[model samples]
Target: MAKKPEDKVLAQNKKANHDYFIEETIEAGIVLQGTEIKSIRNAKVQLKDAFIRIRNNEAWISNMHISPYEQGNRFNHDPLRSRKLLLHKKQISTLIGETKRDGYTIVPLKMYLKNGFAKVLIGVGKGKKEYDKRDVLKKKEAKRDMDRAFKERNQ
Candidate 1:
Protein backbone atom coordinates (compact mmCIF):
# COMPACT_ATOMS: atom_id res chain seq x y z
CA MET A 1 0.00 0.00 0.00
CA ALA A 2 1.14 3.48 -0.74
CA LYS A 3 1.96 5.67 2.26
CA LYS A 4 -0.40 8.53 2.83
CA PRO A 5 1.03 12.00 2.83
CA GLU A 6 1.02 13.64 6.21
CA ASP A 7 -0.17 17.17 6.76
CA LYS A 8 2.62 19.66 7.40
CA VAL A 9 2.43 21.29 10.81
CA LEU A 10 3.53 24.90 10.86
CA ALA A 11 3.41 25.51 14.58
CA GLN A 12 1.82 24.32 17.83
CA ASN A 13 0.94 25.99 21.12
CA LYS A 14 2.40 23.54 23.60
CA LYS A 15 1.38 25.79 26.48
CA ALA A 16 -2.25 25.35 25.56
CA ASN A 17 -2.14 21.80 26.90
CA HIS A 18 -0.54 22.92 30.15
CA ASP A 19 -2.77 25.91 30.81
CA TYR A 20 -6.17 24.58 29.78
CA PHE A 21 -8.24 21.45 30.15
CA ILE A 22 -9.30 20.79 26.60
CA GLU A 23 -12.72 19.20 26.27
CA GLU A 24 -13.17 19.18 22.51
CA THR A 25 -11.29 20.10 19.38
CA ILE A 26 -12.25 21.07 15.85
CA GLU A 27 -10.36 22.01 12.70
CA ALA A 28 -11.12 25.34 11.06
CA GLY A 29 -9.82 27.18 8.03
CA ILE A 30 -7.94 30.45 8.36
CA VAL A 31 -8.12 33.50 6.14
CA LEU A 32 -4.66 34.54 5.02
CA GLN A 33 -3.32 37.34 2.90
CA GLY A 34 -0.99 36.76 -0.05
CA THR A 35 2.15 37.51 1.93
CA GLU A 36 0.79 35.60 4.90
CA ILE A 37 0.39 32.46 2.86
CA LYS A 38 3.91 32.82 1.54
CA SER A 39 5.21 33.11 5.06
CA ILE A 40 3.18 30.11 6.17
CA ARG A 41 4.50 28.03 3.32
CA ASN A 42 7.96 28.74 4.65
CA ALA A 43 6.85 27.52 8.12
CA LYS A 44 7.15 30.94 9.72
CA VAL A 45 4.30 30.94 12.17
CA GLN A 46 3.86 30.89 15.91
CA LEU A 47 0.85 29.71 17.93
CA LYS A 48 2.11 30.69 21.37
CA ASP A 49 -0.16 33.02 23.29
CA ALA A 50 -2.75 32.74 20.55
CA PHE A 51 -6.41 32.40 21.37
CA ILE A 52 -9.79 32.37 19.69
CA ARG A 53 -12.71 34.64 20.34
CA ILE A 54 -16.27 34.75 19.07
CA ARG A 55 -17.82 38.14 18.35
CA ASN A 56 -20.98 38.87 16.43
CA ASN A 57 -21.14 35.16 15.56
CA GLU A 58 -17.73 35.26 13.93
CA ALA A 59 -14.68 33.47 15.24
CA TRP A 60 -11.34 35.25 15.17
CA ILE A 61 -7.89 34.23 16.27
CA SER A 62 -5.86 36.78 18.15
CA ASN A 63 -2.15 37.05 18.83
CA MET A 64 -1.13 34.66 16.10
CA HIS A 65 2.28 35.65 14.74
CA ILE A 66 3.00 34.86 11.15
CA SER A 67 6.36 36.24 10.19
CA PRO A 68 6.53 38.44 7.17
CA TYR A 69 8.03 36.89 4.10
CA GLU A 70 11.59 38.01 3.58
CA GLN A 71 10.96 38.74 -0.06
CA GLY A 72 7.54 40.29 0.42
CA ASN A 73 9.00 43.84 0.11
CA ARG A 74 6.45 46.53 1.01
CA PHE A 75 3.58 44.06 0.87
CA ASN A 76 4.73 42.17 3.94
CA HIS A 77 1.88 41.35 6.28
CA ASP A 78 1.79 42.18 9.93
CA PRO A 79 3.55 39.73 12.20
CA LEU A 80 0.88 39.82 14.86
CA ARG A 81 -2.65 40.40 13.67
CA SER A 82 -6.11 39.10 14.37
CA ARG A 83 -7.06 36.56 11.74
CA LYS A 84 -10.53 35.39 10.85
CA LEU A 85 -11.40 31.75 11.23
CA LEU A 86 -13.89 30.08 8.93
CA LEU A 87 -16.45 27.73 10.37
CA HIS A 88 -20.00 26.74 9.63
CA LYS A 89 -22.81 28.81 11.08
CA LYS A 90 -23.81 25.96 13.35
CA GLN A 91 -20.29 25.55 14.66
CA ILE A 92 -20.00 29.25 15.29
CA SER A 93 -23.25 29.26 17.23
CA THR A 94 -22.17 26.29 19.30
CA LEU A 95 -18.80 27.87 20.08
CA ILE A 96 -20.47 31.14 21.07
CA GLY A 97 -22.75 29.31 23.46
CA GLU A 98 -19.91 27.38 24.99
CA THR A 99 -17.70 30.43 25.42
CA LYS A 100 -20.45 32.22 27.31
CA ARG A 101 -19.96 29.81 30.21
CA ASP A 102 -17.61 30.98 32.93
CA GLY A 103 -13.95 30.02 32.51
CA TYR A 104 -14.58 28.49 29.10
CA THR A 105 -12.60 29.76 26.12
CA ILE A 106 -11.35 28.73 22.73
CA VAL A 107 -7.65 28.08 22.17
CA PRO A 108 -5.70 27.19 19.12
CA LEU A 109 -3.78 23.96 19.65
CA LYS A 110 -1.99 23.64 16.35
CA MET A 111 -1.58 25.13 12.90
CA TYR A 112 -1.05 22.96 9.85
CA LEU A 113 -1.36 22.93 6.11
CA LYS A 114 -3.95 20.61 4.66
CA ASN A 115 -4.22 20.25 0.93
CA GLY A 116 -2.40 23.54 0.44
CA PHE A 117 -4.69 25.40 2.83
CA ALA A 118 -3.81 26.62 6.28
CA LYS A 119 -5.96 25.15 9.03
CA VAL A 120 -6.07 25.54 12.76
CA LEU A 121 -6.99 22.95 15.34
CA ILE A 122 -8.96 24.75 18.02
CA GLY A 123 -10.13 23.34 21.31
CA VAL A 124 -12.78 24.23 23.83
CA GLY A 125 -10.83 24.57 27.03
CA LYS A 126 -11.42 25.55 30.61
CA GLY A 127 -8.82 27.28 32.74
CA LYS A 128 -6.96 25.10 35.17
CA LYS A 129 -6.23 26.01 38.75
CA GLU A 130 -2.67 26.07 40.09
CA TYR A 131 -3.28 22.88 42.01
CA ASP A 132 -4.50 21.18 38.89
CA LYS A 133 -1.33 22.20 37.09
CA ARG A 134 0.83 20.75 39.82
CA ASP A 135 -1.14 17.53 39.81
CA VAL A 136 -0.67 17.16 36.09
CA LEU A 137 3.09 17.61 36.48
CA LYS A 138 3.19 15.00 39.19
CA LYS A 139 1.31 12.52 37.02
CA LYS A 140 3.64 13.17 34.12
CA GLU A 141 6.67 12.54 36.34
CA ALA A 142 5.16 9.27 37.56
CA LYS A 143 4.43 8.16 34.02
CA ARG A 144 7.99 8.89 32.95
CA ASP A 145 9.38 6.89 35.84
CA MET A 146 7.15 3.94 35.03
CA ASP A 147 8.15 4.07 31.37
CA ARG A 148 11.86 4.03 32.28
CA ALA A 149 11.43 1.12 34.69
CA PHE A 150 9.48 -0.88 32.16
CA LYS A 151 12.10 -0.30 29.50
CA GLU A 152 14.88 -1.52 31.82
CA ARG A 153 12.92 -4.65 32.70
CA ASN A 154 12.28 -5.47 29.03
CA GLN A 155 15.96 -4.95 28.24
Candidate 2:
Protein backbone atom coordinates (compact mmCIF):
# COMPACT_ATOMS: atom_id res chain seq x y z
CA MET A 1 0.00 0.00 0.00
CA ALA A 2 1.09 3.54 -0.68
CA LYS A 3 2.34 5.33 2.38
CA LYS A 4 0.60 8.44 3.59
CA PRO A 5 2.79 11.32 4.78
CA GLU A 6 0.24 12.51 7.32
CA ASP A 7 0.34 8.98 8.66
CA LYS A 8 4.11 9.39 8.65
CA VAL A 9 5.17 8.02 12.03
CA LEU A 10 4.74 10.21 15.08
CA ALA A 11 6.63 7.97 17.47
CA GLN A 12 8.15 4.50 17.57
CA ASN A 13 9.12 2.33 20.53
CA LYS A 14 12.28 0.72 19.21
CA LYS A 15 13.24 -0.27 22.74
CA ALA A 16 10.16 -2.46 22.91
CA ASN A 17 11.51 -4.54 20.02
CA HIS A 18 14.96 -4.79 21.61
CA ASP A 19 13.65 -5.74 25.03
CA TYR A 20 10.90 -8.10 23.94
CA PHE A 21 10.17 -10.59 21.22
CA ILE A 22 7.16 -9.14 19.46
CA GLU A 23 5.07 -12.06 18.28
CA GLU A 24 2.47 -10.10 16.37
CA THR A 25 1.33 -6.54 15.85
CA ILE A 26 -2.07 -5.20 14.95
CA GLU A 27 -3.18 -1.77 13.83
CA ALA A 28 -5.63 -0.38 16.37
CA GLY A 29 -7.54 2.87 16.37
CA ILE A 30 -6.92 5.51 19.04
CA VAL A 31 -9.51 7.74 20.64
CA LEU A 32 -8.11 11.27 20.44
CA GLN A 33 -9.34 14.82 20.81
CA GLY A 34 -9.07 17.45 18.08
CA THR A 35 -6.08 19.08 19.74
CA GLU A 36 -4.42 15.74 20.29
CA ILE A 37 -4.59 14.97 16.62
CA LYS A 38 -3.23 18.38 15.79
CA SER A 39 -0.36 17.92 18.19
CA ILE A 40 0.41 14.55 16.67
CA ARG A 41 0.45 16.03 13.20
CA ASN A 42 3.05 18.50 14.41
CA ALA A 43 5.20 15.59 15.63
CA LYS A 44 5.13 16.82 19.18
CA VAL A 45 4.81 13.34 20.66
CA GLN A 46 6.98 11.04 22.73
CA LEU A 47 6.56 7.27 22.98
CA LYS A 48 9.72 6.32 24.83
CA ASP A 49 7.95 5.97 28.15
CA ALA A 50 4.61 4.92 26.71
CA PHE A 51 3.08 1.52 27.29
CA ILE A 52 -0.14 -0.41 26.90
CA ARG A 53 -2.37 -1.61 29.69
CA ILE A 54 -5.28 -4.02 29.59
CA ARG A 55 -8.15 -2.83 31.75
CA ASN A 56 -11.81 -3.74 31.99
CA ASN A 57 -11.71 -5.80 28.80
CA GLU A 58 -10.00 -3.02 26.86
CA ALA A 59 -6.55 -1.65 26.11
CA TRP A 60 -5.33 1.86 26.85
CA ILE A 61 -2.09 3.62 26.09
CA SER A 62 -0.42 5.39 29.00
CA ASN A 63 2.57 7.73 29.34
CA MET A 64 2.46 8.88 25.75
CA HIS A 65 3.01 12.64 25.47
CA ILE A 66 1.37 14.74 22.83
CA SER A 67 2.32 18.35 23.34
CA PRO A 68 -0.29 21.05 23.59
CA TYR A 69 -1.57 22.42 20.33
CA GLU A 70 -0.74 26.05 19.62
CA GLN A 71 -4.30 26.84 18.66
CA GLY A 72 -6.00 24.91 21.42
CA ASN A 73 -7.54 26.50 24.50
CA ARG A 74 -8.59 24.74 27.72
CA PHE A 75 -10.41 22.11 25.65
CA ASN A 76 -7.01 20.69 24.68
CA HIS A 77 -6.50 17.19 25.99
CA ASP A 78 -3.86 16.48 28.54
CA PRO A 79 -0.54 15.40 27.08
CA LEU A 80 -0.07 12.33 29.22
CA ARG A 81 -3.55 11.04 29.80
CA SER A 82 -4.49 7.43 29.16
CA ARG A 83 -6.14 6.99 25.78
CA LYS A 84 -8.36 4.05 24.92
CA LEU A 85 -7.40 1.76 22.06
CA LEU A 86 -9.97 0.35 19.69
CA LEU A 87 -9.51 -3.36 19.20
CA HIS A 88 -11.59 -6.41 18.56
CA LYS A 89 -13.17 -8.21 21.54
CA LYS A 90 -11.38 -11.41 20.58
CA GLN A 91 -8.02 -9.63 20.45
CA ILE A 92 -8.53 -8.13 23.88
CA SER A 93 -9.46 -11.50 25.35
CA THR A 94 -6.42 -13.16 23.82
CA LEU A 95 -4.12 -10.43 25.12
CA ILE A 96 -5.63 -10.67 28.59
CA GLY A 97 -5.06 -14.42 28.64
CA GLU A 98 -1.47 -14.24 27.40
CA THR A 99 -0.62 -11.40 29.74
CA LYS A 100 -1.84 -13.46 32.65
CA ARG A 101 0.86 -15.95 31.75
CA ASP A 102 4.50 -15.43 32.78
CA GLY A 103 6.80 -12.97 31.01
CA TYR A 104 4.25 -11.86 28.41
CA THR A 105 2.83 -8.41 27.84
CA ILE A 106 1.10 -5.95 25.59
CA VAL A 107 3.25 -3.15 24.15
CA PRO A 108 2.87 -0.32 21.74
CA LEU A 109 5.38 -0.45 18.89
CA LYS A 110 4.46 2.56 16.77
CA MET A 111 1.96 5.37 16.39
CA TYR A 112 0.67 6.82 13.15
CA LEU A 113 -2.49 7.91 11.42
CA LYS A 114 -4.48 5.83 8.96
CA ASN A 115 -6.84 7.50 6.53
CA GLY A 116 -6.85 10.59 8.71
CA PHE A 117 -7.60 8.59 11.86
CA ALA A 118 -5.05 8.06 14.60
CA LYS A 119 -3.81 4.50 14.88
CA VAL A 120 -1.37 2.62 17.07
CA LEU A 121 0.64 -0.50 16.35
CA ILE A 122 0.10 -2.76 19.32
CA GLY A 123 2.05 -5.98 19.82
CA VAL A 124 1.72 -9.13 21.82
CA GLY A 125 5.25 -9.53 23.16
CA LYS A 126 7.27 -11.83 25.32
CA GLY A 127 10.11 -10.34 27.34
CA LYS A 128 13.55 -11.46 26.23
CA LYS A 129 16.02 -12.76 28.75
CA GLU A 130 19.49 -11.23 29.12
CA TYR A 131 20.96 -14.13 27.17
CA ASP A 132 18.46 -13.61 24.39
CA LYS A 133 19.43 -9.95 24.02
CA ARG A 134 23.13 -10.87 24.01
CA ASP A 135 22.55 -13.44 21.30
CA VAL A 136 20.69 -10.92 19.18
CA LEU A 137 23.50 -8.42 19.57
CA LYS A 138 26.04 -11.02 18.56
CA LYS A 139 24.01 -11.93 15.50
CA LYS A 140 23.77 -8.28 14.51
CA GLU A 141 27.51 -7.81 14.83
CA ALA A 142 28.16 -10.94 12.77
CA LYS A 143 25.79 -9.73 10.07
CA ARG A 144 27.46 -6.33 9.95
CA ASP A 145 30.91 -7.88 9.56
CA MET A 146 29.66 -10.26 6.91
CA ASP A 147 28.13 -7.39 4.94
CA ARG A 148 31.37 -5.43 5.08
CA ALA A 149 33.36 -8.44 3.85
CA PHE A 150 30.91 -9.08 1.03
CA LYS A 151 31.08 -5.44 -0.11
CA GLU A 152 34.93 -5.51 -0.25
CA ARG A 153 34.87 -8.83 -2.11
CA ASN A 154 32.42 -7.49 -4.70
CA GLN A 155 34.49 -4.34 -5.19
Candidate 3:
Protein backbone atom coordinates (compact mmCIF):
# COMPACT_ATOMS: atom_id res chain seq x y z
CA MET A 1 0.00 0.00 0.00
CA ALA A 2 1.18 3.47 -0.79
CA LYS A 3 1.75 5.75 2.15
CA LYS A 4 -0.22 8.95 2.27
CA PRO A 5 1.63 12.22 1.91
CA GLU A 6 2.14 14.02 5.19
CA ASP A 7 0.79 17.43 5.94
CA LYS A 8 3.20 20.31 6.61
CA VAL A 9 4.89 18.87 9.68
CA LEU A 10 5.96 21.56 12.13
CA ALA A 11 7.38 19.49 14.97
CA GLN A 12 7.79 15.86 15.98
CA ASN A 13 8.64 13.99 19.14
CA LYS A 14 11.25 11.50 17.93
CA LYS A 15 11.77 10.16 21.44
CA ALA A 16 8.10 9.21 21.73
CA ASN A 17 8.55 6.21 19.42
CA HIS A 18 11.80 5.23 21.09
CA ASP A 19 10.43 5.30 24.66
CA TYR A 20 6.91 3.94 24.11
CA PHE A 21 4.86 1.59 21.98
CA ILE A 22 2.28 3.82 20.33
CA GLU A 23 -0.94 1.83 20.08
CA GLU A 24 -3.20 4.38 18.40
CA THR A 25 -3.00 7.90 17.01
CA ILE A 26 -5.67 10.58 16.76
CA GLU A 27 -5.45 13.95 15.08
CA ALA A 28 -6.92 16.82 17.06
CA GLY A 29 -7.20 20.54 16.45
CA ILE A 30 -5.25 22.95 18.60
CA VAL A 31 -6.47 26.26 20.04
CA LEU A 32 -3.75 28.74 19.34
CA GLN A 33 -3.39 32.42 19.93
CA GLY A 34 -2.63 34.84 17.08
CA THR A 35 1.10 34.90 17.63
CA GLU A 36 1.17 31.21 18.36
CA ILE A 37 -0.27 30.40 14.95
CA LYS A 38 2.27 32.66 13.33
CA SER A 39 5.05 30.91 15.18
CA ILE A 40 3.75 27.50 14.15
CA ARG A 41 3.55 28.52 10.51
CA ASN A 42 7.19 29.51 10.72
CA ALA A 43 8.00 25.99 11.99
CA LYS A 44 9.29 27.26 15.32
CA VAL A 45 7.58 24.65 17.49
CA GLN A 46 8.92 21.79 19.60
CA LEU A 47 7.15 18.60 20.64
CA LYS A 48 10.08 16.74 22.13
CA ASP A 49 8.78 16.81 25.71
CA ALA A 50 5.08 17.36 25.06
CA PHE A 51 2.36 15.04 26.33
CA ILE A 52 -1.42 15.01 26.30
CA ARG A 53 -3.41 15.27 29.46
CA ILE A 54 -7.12 14.92 30.21
CA ARG A 55 -8.38 17.53 32.63
CA ASN A 56 -11.96 18.50 33.50
CA ASN A 57 -13.14 16.19 30.71
CA GLU A 58 -11.08 18.04 28.14
CA ALA A 59 -7.81 17.09 26.48
CA TRP A 60 -4.91 19.47 26.83
CA ILE A 61 -1.42 19.35 25.40
CA SER A 62 1.08 20.16 28.11
CA ASN A 63 4.69 21.22 27.76
CA MET A 64 4.51 21.81 24.02
CA HIS A 65 6.77 24.72 23.06
CA ILE A 66 5.85 27.12 20.32
CA SER A 67 8.38 29.90 20.05
CA PRO A 68 7.16 33.46 20.05
CA TYR A 69 6.82 35.06 16.67
CA GLU A 70 9.81 37.21 15.77
CA GLN A 71 7.77 40.41 15.44
CA GLY A 72 5.03 39.51 17.94
CA ASN A 73 6.17 42.08 20.50
CA ARG A 74 3.90 42.36 23.56
CA PHE A 75 1.16 40.24 22.02
CA ASN A 76 3.30 37.11 21.85
CA HIS A 77 1.99 34.08 23.67
CA ASP A 78 3.82 32.03 26.23
CA PRO A 79 6.14 29.40 24.82
CA LEU A 80 5.33 26.72 27.38
CA ARG A 81 1.65 27.15 28.16
CA SER A 82 -0.71 24.17 28.13
CA ARG A 83 -2.85 24.42 25.03
CA LYS A 84 -6.32 22.94 24.68
CA LEU A 85 -6.95 20.15 22.17
CA LEU A 86 -10.20 19.82 20.32
CA LEU A 87 -11.64 16.31 20.12
CA HIS A 88 -15.03 14.65 20.04
CA LYS A 89 -16.53 13.71 23.36
CA LYS A 90 -16.47 10.03 22.54
CA GLN A 91 -12.81 10.23 21.57
CA ILE A 92 -11.97 11.96 24.83
CA SER A 93 -13.82 9.28 26.75
CA THR A 94 -11.90 6.53 24.99
CA LEU A 95 -8.61 8.26 25.72
CA ILE A 96 -9.54 8.60 29.35
CA GLY A 97 -10.22 4.89 29.52
CA GLU A 98 -6.99 3.98 27.83
CA THR A 99 -4.85 6.22 30.01
CA LYS A 100 -6.24 4.74 33.21
CA ARG A 101 -4.28 1.58 32.54
CA ASP A 102 -0.88 1.33 34.16
CA GLY A 103 2.04 2.45 32.01
CA TYR A 104 -0.36 3.75 29.37
CA THR A 105 -0.42 7.46 28.59
CA ILE A 106 -1.27 10.00 25.94
CA VAL A 107 1.65 11.43 24.00
CA PRO A 108 1.94 13.98 21.26
CA LEU A 109 3.54 12.28 18.26
CA LYS A 110 3.66 15.17 15.84
CA MET A 111 2.40 18.68 15.18
CA TYR A 112 1.48 19.87 11.72
CA LEU A 113 -0.51 22.40 9.75
CA LYS A 114 -3.63 21.13 7.97
CA ASN A 115 -5.68 23.56 5.91
CA GLY A 116 -4.09 26.55 7.64
CA PHE A 117 -4.86 25.16 11.10
CA ALA A 118 -2.50 23.60 13.58
CA LYS A 119 -3.24 19.96 14.22
CA VAL A 120 -1.59 17.63 16.67
CA LEU A 121 -1.29 13.90 16.17
CA ILE A 122 -1.64 12.38 19.60
CA GLY A 123 -1.11 8.72 20.41
CA VAL A 124 -2.03 6.30 23.12
CA GLY A 125 1.26 4.73 24.10
CA LYS A 126 2.53 2.29 26.64
CA GLY A 127 5.96 2.80 28.16
CA LYS A 128 8.67 0.41 27.04
CA LYS A 129 11.02 -1.37 29.41
CA GLU A 130 14.79 -1.25 28.95
CA TYR A 131 14.81 -4.80 27.66
CA ASP A 132 12.06 -4.01 25.17
CA LYS A 133 14.06 -1.10 23.78
CA ARG A 134 17.18 -3.26 23.45
CA ASP A 135 15.18 -5.97 21.69
CA VAL A 136 13.79 -3.46 19.22
CA LEU A 137 17.27 -2.10 18.47
CA LYS A 138 18.56 -5.65 17.87
CA LYS A 139 15.69 -6.40 15.50
CA LYS A 140 16.28 -3.18 13.61
CA GLU A 141 20.02 -3.96 13.27
CA ALA A 142 19.21 -7.46 11.95
CA LYS A 143 16.80 -6.02 9.40
CA ARG A 144 19.43 -3.52 8.25
CA ASP A 145 21.99 -6.33 7.83
CA MET A 146 19.51 -8.39 5.82
CA ASP A 147 18.69 -5.46 3.55
CA ARG A 148 22.42 -4.77 2.99
CA ALA A 149 23.03 -8.42 2.04
CA PHE A 150 20.07 -8.37 -0.35
CA LYS A 151 21.43 -5.20 -2.03
CA GLU A 152 24.87 -6.82 -2.44
CA ARG A 153 23.34 -9.92 -3.99
CA ASN A 154 21.33 -7.80 -6.45
CA GLN A 155 24.46 -5.85 -7.39
Candidate 4:
Protein backbone atom coordinates (compact mmCIF):
# COMPACT_ATOMS: atom_id res chain seq x y z
CA MET A 1 0.00 0.00 0.00
CA ALA A 2 1.22 3.46 -0.87
CA LYS A 3 0.39 6.65 0.95
CA LYS A 4 -0.95 9.47 -1.18
CA PRO A 5 0.42 12.94 -0.72
CA GLU A 6 -2.15 15.47 0.43
CA ASP A 7 -2.90 18.67 -1.42
CA LYS A 8 -1.14 21.63 0.16
CA VAL A 9 -3.75 24.15 1.29
CA LEU A 10 -2.56 27.71 0.70
CA ALA A 11 -5.36 29.89 2.04
CA GLN A 12 -8.90 29.57 3.37
CA ASN A 13 -11.83 31.94 3.84
CA LYS A 14 -12.75 31.18 7.42
CA LYS A 15 -15.56 33.70 7.51
CA ALA A 16 -17.36 32.10 4.61
CA ASN A 17 -18.93 29.50 6.87
CA HIS A 18 -20.07 32.11 9.38
CA ASP A 19 -21.46 34.57 6.86
CA TYR A 20 -23.32 32.23 4.57
CA PHE A 21 -24.76 28.74 4.35
CA ILE A 22 -22.68 26.85 1.81
CA GLU A 23 -24.95 24.71 -0.38
CA GLU A 24 -22.50 23.10 -2.73
CA THR A 25 -18.81 23.28 -3.50
CA ILE A 26 -16.94 22.81 -6.74
CA GLU A 27 -13.22 22.45 -7.43
CA ALA A 28 -11.89 24.52 -10.27
CA GLY A 29 -8.45 25.20 -11.69
CA ILE A 30 -7.16 28.75 -11.66
CA VAL A 31 -5.22 30.71 -14.23
CA LEU A 32 -2.22 32.17 -12.46
CA GLN A 33 0.65 34.33 -13.63
CA GLY A 34 4.22 33.15 -13.17
CA THR A 35 4.81 35.19 -10.05
CA GLU A 36 1.43 34.31 -8.64
CA ILE A 37 2.33 30.66 -8.50
CA LYS A 38 5.55 31.44 -6.72
CA SER A 39 3.70 33.53 -4.15
CA ILE A 40 1.20 30.72 -3.61
CA ARG A 41 4.04 28.24 -3.08
CA ASN A 42 5.12 30.43 -0.20
CA ALA A 43 1.53 30.55 1.17
CA LYS A 44 1.23 34.26 0.44
CA VAL A 45 -2.39 34.15 -0.62
CA GLN A 46 -5.55 35.44 1.06
CA LEU A 47 -8.99 34.09 0.26
CA LYS A 48 -10.78 36.48 2.56
CA ASP A 49 -13.01 38.91 0.63
CA ALA A 50 -12.61 36.76 -2.46
CA PHE A 51 -15.64 35.77 -4.52
CA ILE A 52 -16.57 34.13 -7.79
CA ARG A 53 -18.47 35.78 -10.59
CA ILE A 54 -19.90 34.35 -13.76
CA ARG A 55 -19.87 36.53 -16.84
CA ASN A 56 -20.20 35.65 -20.51
CA ASN A 57 -20.39 31.98 -19.64
CA GLU A 58 -17.01 32.14 -17.89
CA ALA A 59 -16.12 31.87 -14.22
CA TRP A 60 -13.77 34.38 -12.67
CA ILE A 61 -12.45 34.94 -9.18
CA SER A 62 -12.29 38.53 -7.98
CA ASN A 63 -10.63 40.13 -4.93
CA MET A 64 -8.31 37.24 -4.28
CA HIS A 65 -5.11 38.75 -2.94
CA ILE A 66 -1.91 37.03 -3.89
CA SER A 67 1.00 38.96 -2.46
CA PRO A 68 3.71 40.08 -4.82
CA TYR A 69 6.62 37.72 -5.02
CA GLU A 70 9.68 39.18 -3.34
CA GLN A 71 11.96 38.29 -6.26
CA GLY A 72 9.41 39.09 -8.96
CA ASN A 73 10.10 42.83 -9.06
CA ARG A 74 8.70 44.11 -12.40
CA PHE A 75 7.36 40.68 -13.24
CA ASN A 76 5.01 40.55 -10.28
CA HIS A 77 1.37 40.22 -11.20
CA ASP A 78 -1.29 42.53 -9.86
CA PRO A 79 -2.15 41.49 -6.33
CA LEU A 80 -5.94 41.91 -6.70
CA ARG A 81 -6.53 41.25 -10.36
CA SER A 82 -9.47 39.10 -11.38
CA ARG A 83 -8.26 35.66 -12.39
CA LYS A 84 -10.05 33.21 -14.65
CA LEU A 85 -11.35 30.01 -13.15
CA LEU A 86 -11.14 26.89 -15.30
CA LEU A 87 -14.50 25.22 -15.04
CA HIS A 88 -16.43 23.27 -17.63
CA LYS A 89 -19.40 24.73 -19.43
CA LYS A 90 -21.74 22.50 -17.50
CA GLN A 91 -20.36 23.67 -14.21
CA ILE A 92 -20.52 27.29 -15.25
CA SER A 93 -24.13 26.90 -16.21
CA THR A 94 -24.85 25.32 -12.88
CA LEU A 95 -23.25 28.23 -11.10
CA ILE A 96 -25.16 30.70 -13.17
CA GLY A 97 -28.46 29.04 -12.34
CA GLU A 98 -27.53 28.84 -8.69
CA THR A 99 -26.56 32.47 -8.42
CA LYS A 100 -29.78 33.62 -10.08
CA ARG A 101 -31.65 32.64 -6.95
CA ASP A 102 -32.37 35.31 -4.36
CA GLY A 103 -29.63 35.89 -1.79
CA TYR A 104 -27.43 33.20 -3.28
CA THR A 105 -23.82 33.98 -4.10
CA ILE A 106 -20.66 32.33 -5.23
CA VAL A 107 -17.80 32.57 -2.77
CA PRO A 108 -14.30 31.25 -2.65
CA LEU A 109 -13.89 28.75 0.18
CA LYS A 110 -10.32 27.53 -0.12
CA MET A 111 -7.29 27.78 -2.34
CA TYR A 112 -4.64 25.11 -2.61
CA LEU A 113 -2.01 23.53 -4.83
CA LYS A 114 -3.11 20.28 -6.34
CA ASN A 115 -0.64 18.38 -8.52
CA GLY A 116 1.56 21.46 -8.86
CA PHE A 117 -1.34 23.58 -10.09
CA ALA A 118 -3.38 26.07 -8.15
CA LYS A 119 -7.02 25.17 -7.56
CA VAL A 120 -9.84 26.84 -5.72
CA LEU A 121 -12.87 25.45 -3.95
CA ILE A 122 -15.86 27.61 -4.69
CA GLY A 123 -19.30 27.28 -3.12
CA VAL A 124 -22.83 28.42 -3.73
CA GLY A 125 -23.83 30.09 -0.48
CA LYS A 126 -27.00 31.70 0.73
CA GLY A 127 -26.73 34.68 3.04
CA LYS A 128 -27.54 34.14 6.69
CA LYS A 129 -29.48 36.46 8.95
CA GLU A 130 -28.22 37.92 12.23
CA TYR A 131 -30.28 35.49 14.25
CA ASP A 132 -28.93 32.62 12.21
CA LYS A 133 -25.41 33.58 13.15
CA ARG A 134 -26.32 33.68 16.81
CA ASP A 135 -27.96 30.27 16.56
CA VAL A 136 -24.87 28.72 15.03
CA LEU A 137 -22.68 30.16 17.75
CA LYS A 138 -24.96 28.88 20.49
CA LYS A 139 -24.99 25.41 18.98
CA LYS A 140 -21.22 25.39 18.83
CA GLU A 141 -20.96 26.43 22.47
CA ALA A 142 -23.42 23.75 23.51
CA LYS A 143 -21.43 21.11 21.64
CA ARG A 144 -18.25 22.21 23.38
CA ASP A 145 -19.90 22.04 26.79
CA MET A 146 -21.31 18.62 26.08
CA ASP A 147 -17.90 17.35 25.07
CA ARG A 148 -16.39 18.73 28.27
CA ALA A 149 -19.03 17.00 30.39
CA PHE A 150 -18.48 13.71 28.55
CA LYS A 151 -14.72 13.96 29.12
CA GLU A 152 -15.21 14.61 32.83
CA ARG A 153 -17.49 11.61 33.17
CA ASN A 154 -14.92 9.37 31.47
CA GLN A 155 -12.15 10.64 33.74
Candidate 4's residue-wise lDDT over 34-153, tens digit each? Answer: 788999999999999998888899999999999999999899998999999999898899889999999999998888888898888888999999999999999999999999999999
Residue 91 in model 2: shift from native, Å?
1.3
lDDT of every model, 2 decimals:
0.89, 0.86, 0.90, 0.90
Candidate 1 lDDT tens digits, 80-144:
98999999998898888888899999999888888899889999999999999999999999999
Worst 10 residues of 2 by lDDT: 1-10
lDDT by residue (tens digit), candidate 2, 1-155: 11333557888889998999988777888998778888888878888888899889889999999999988988788899999999889888887887898999888888887788778888889999999999999999999999999999999
The residue ranges of model 3 lying beyond 4 angstroms of the native Cα positions read 1-5
Clashes of each: 0, 0, 0, 0
lDDT of 3: 0.90
Measured by TM-score, how close is model 3 to the native structure? Answer: 0.95
Q: Which residue pairs come into collision in candidate 3?
A: none
Clashing pairs in 1: none
For residues 77-96, what per-residue lDDT tens digits would candidate 3 score against the true structure?
Answer: 88999999999999999999
Question: In candidate 1, how many Å is residue 4 off?
Answer: 14
Cα TM-score of candidate 1: 0.94
Q: State TM-scores per candidate.
A: 0.94, 0.91, 0.95, 0.95
